[model samples]
Target: MNGNVPASTRTLRVLTFLATQPGPVPMERIASAVGLPRSSTYHLLKAMISEGFVVHLPEEKRYGLGVAAFEIGSAYLRHDPLERLARPLLAQLVAEIGQTAHLGVLHGRELVYLLKEQPPRPVTLVTDVGVRLPATLTASGRALLAELPPAQVRALFPTPESFVRRTEQGPQTLTQLRRILADEKRQGYAVEDSHITPGVASVASAAVDHAGHPVAAISVTFRTDAIPSSERFLLARRTRQAADALTRRLRG
Candidate 1:
């Protein structure tokens, strides 16, 4: 076995620790967390900072994620093969469910709608492609959160103050959000009704990577009263199926 760690492994460990930590971590904290010598950690940090994957806080002398990290993430969306594969599947979802279907990815603390498929109906939905919404308040967000490790989930929204409600039904605190994610995990889907708009409801499930991290979520949004009670589970199941198919195609 190799006695020394590779530079790639060291950088990954540092990034993962920073991601899981609640806030910007100091150089010392990163060194302790990644089990690297202080001098080596500083050198690694300097290289990462130069590459734009990490940023240093001049005021607090701490480090946080930077723009280049987001570019790497945006690359996932821009170059994704899933979108091409998902178009036919999402079209089927829209046709069968008689509602709009969406594919959303979690970006930082927000869910960005990457694609929106509207059914051939007289009424149209307000949600469009490229819309951004509060993740803690959306069905797609909850589905993604269900796939996250618990500690990372907590770090994403550390306190009640971290939750920003776009509507009255949204979770009001970290405890409440935790409970929601738990329920979503148990049920294998997430439900959001009247969170963004009155009379609107959505149910979703995640598209997970090979490591079981959520890459995105598939959802169906429609008028709450228009959907029959018996069909709700079916809709949820369809969303999950679409998500699973997309994940398999992407990860495999």
Candidate 2:
């Protein structure tokens, strides 16, 4: 409380101050430098700790930026490059496939679509840029999830409650989801039928980084009537090709 300076402003000041430091700094110094009472600083830090914006090193009595903070910084730097590489590919995919295509990234346990493309005679779809959906439910989300380590996947979904419902489809438990992900991983692609919206289906593949971790997913969604389940893997293969192209660009 620096004479009515907002808590949000003060927290930002603390983050700015911490960013200037070479590494973690002790609480006393942070509170003093940010001009906040020690008690208020402690509470603010606790909140940040819960949200993964800050980490507490108990033995050293120090605080530092956490992985979430790192992700935010990395995202800022990556936004232009990732989108620049994917936009044209999505446009091309829509044109060639005559369907809707999208680029999605995982945000926490959900999929956040970052880019979307529609064919000239597009069918209206519920998914669009910035729309978030359950990772265990969408084809593209599963494609991304399939690339993550099993342990990380378990950590992301520890219990049955984590599985959300949409159109009464998709897995209801971690065990069931793992089974589906395993098949999708082995197939090198993923597919969903009416999992998000009724009468719609999608095929997807993940773009991997140099380290072989999934960086994003490319998916094409079409009406179930337009594409037969028996022949949907054709779309799957096409999506994989697009994803692989993006993977190479990211790797280079």
**Candidate of highest lDDT:** 2
Q: Tens digit of lDDT per residue, candidate 2, span 68-167?
A: 6645743663487899999999988888888899999887678888999988888898898889899889998899889876644665687888889878
On a 0 to 1 TM-score scale, where does candidate 2 land against the true structure? 0.72
lDDT for predicted candidate 2 compared with the true structure: 0.84
lDDT of 1: 0.80
lDDT (10s digit) by residue, model 1, range 1-252: 132889999899888877665557789989888888888889999999898787777667788765466446645864557578678778988888778999888876788888888877724665667888888888998898777765456556767877886766788887888888999999999999889888888999988765465778888998888998788998899898998888888776
Please give the range of 10 consecutive residues that has the lowest summed lDDT in model 1: 66-75
Candidate 1: pairs in clash: none
Q: Looking at candidate 1, what is the lDDT of residue 212?
A: 61
| Colliding pairs, model 2 | none
Worst 10 residues of 2 by lDDT: 69-78
Task: Estimate every model's Cα lDDT from 0 to 1.
Answer: 0.80, 0.84
